[model samples]
Target: MKKITVLIVLASFFSCTSTKIIVDRPIVFNDEREALTLEYLENRYGLVQNTPTIVPKMIVLHWTVIPTFEKSFEAFDNPTLPNWRPEIKDISGLNVSSQFMIDRDGTIYRLLPETTMARHVIGLNHCAIGIENVGGTEKLPLTKAQLKSNIWLVRYLKDKYDIDYLIGHYEYTLFENHPLWLERDDGYRTKKTDPGQYFMQKVRDAVSDLNFKPLPNED
Candidate 1:
């Protein structure tokens, strides 16, 4: 009887403290953008699924170079790539997006479904979930609230998925030779430095008990 009472109290405590996630799904243009996403998955990632859903095996953290959450949302809200990124226009007009975005205040927003593939990471997009935090520049650094939120979010995702890895955007290159690295064009990679090294270390430390696989050593 005492154990049952303790369990009930613990459940109530968790329910009260659970993080709230706002669903603000982006405009997923189905015409050419969706088609291109499908083709990219198939041709680049060797995924042959009929839909864009993914069996997420990893979580990749990022920092939006943009300063404000509103501006960041505006950029990803569109399905077509804005004209500024003309280099990859031929590949697809589809804009880059993440499954979740965290504001400076630690407000969590869902930009896409958990299983849906988003074009945030380069090679592992087919099997990874992306988390984008606003403001990564020197003038506007990430916040403690954001860090707390990230820890909570990562814990939530780990509980829900069979996630095997957690890495920063900068660490994606380390997986180039791994089976998950499947970009067809070796030269198509973009330089990334997001959610900084220190930030990732903090997050990893907070969730170390989860025992996620360490980033592969660079060969």
Candidate 2:
């Protein structure tokens, strides 16, 4: 019975994969938040959709830079932006979040539904799923365990959806000219360097066989 229960849960959203996803959906997605997401999509992406869902074309990797899993989760669990993030508050109150969060120990936590539009990225939030790692500072770089888990999670998501590109948060700007790029305000961009280069290379190499499409500016 226990085995059957687990299988049922997996069948709902994901395909058969070794990656264990722990659902810790503390981020509020009530009527107000949903309304805000819809407004963001229409205003930012020029998409007047009745829902705030995405088609899942890309997978974005990020590092929280917060040094601990609890603090990182708290940062995103709120419905609206906190006071410190005034730099981006002028854009939208919808707090930044991701579909998945990986702890330093490689424990995978699902913060929101995979198709929900998270404000983690600027130009591609309409169609990209974000994966946030717990720590990304130079003093607390992403761990080996997190790397292994990210590789597995990437493959699992690729097989489950029509994912075409895998990218680190820093590389999102490269898609500015691509058709999938949808941010209306060109000047509303912020620099990012999360889930660093070495970490990205390792994960990409692990899933090399998946043949994800190249970035728009990749040489």
Candidate 3:
């Protein structure tokens, strides 16, 4: 009897948490940062065009420790990274900015228009749509409102762009061995824990219809 009771409790707990674990769709809030353009996308980040060009295949989620939408907007607009983003220097003159930024109140801002190669992630810019969320501190973990907005955005992008994969920023390294890996320095990789794993799962579940590319089988 005790065993059965424990199992039931576990199932209940999991059921309650499951909904919070992953996003069901992409965010679709108003593009507060629409003025940001493709030229800024290129110059802010010294990105070189890859031959054959990359397709819009992945949607990556991120978080800006910096609070507020305007601050995040300014951060993406500038070509130089603030002293905070040491990761920016490794990519040469290339700055770190996503195609989209989600504010604290679940406001979605478009720093750059869709399909344009922004320097949000190295090697995957040609193909990935970056979405950065504001406020990632323990006290300010992403909110449920943000999660719902993310789902809306995912669905919107999936319909609009030929998006294949939806992932969190931390999973970027997992693609190192995959065909998408294009950096000259294969050894050069950054460690990240943005937008949280649980948060990503929520996004993936919401946009599962997009059908992410299957990771190649091990050699």
lDDT of each: 0.82, 0.86, 0.63
Candidate 1 error regions (>4 Å) = 1-19, 29-31
| Cα lDDT tens digits for candidate 3, 80-135 | 54576676564454446777777777666666556655666655666788888988
* Top candidate by lDDT: 2
Which should have the higher lDDT, number 1 or number 2? 2
Off by over 4 Å in 2: 1-19
Output the worst ten-in-a-row residue range by lDDT, candidate 3: 1-10
Candidate 3 accuracy as TM-score: 0.71
Put the candidates in lDDT order, highest first: 2, 1, 3
TM-score of 2: 0.91
Query: Total clashes, candidate 2?
Result: 0
Ranking by TM-score: 2, 1, 3
Question: What would the TM-scores of all predictions be?
Answer: 0.87, 0.91, 0.71
lDDT of 3: 0.63
Please give the range of 10 consecutive residues that has the lowest summed lDDT in model 2. 1-10
Greater-lDDT candidate between 1 and 3: 1
Query: Which of the two, 2 or 3, has more TM-score?
Result: 2
Candidate 2, residues 17-66, lDDT tens digits: the string is 35365656457788888888998999889999888999999999999999
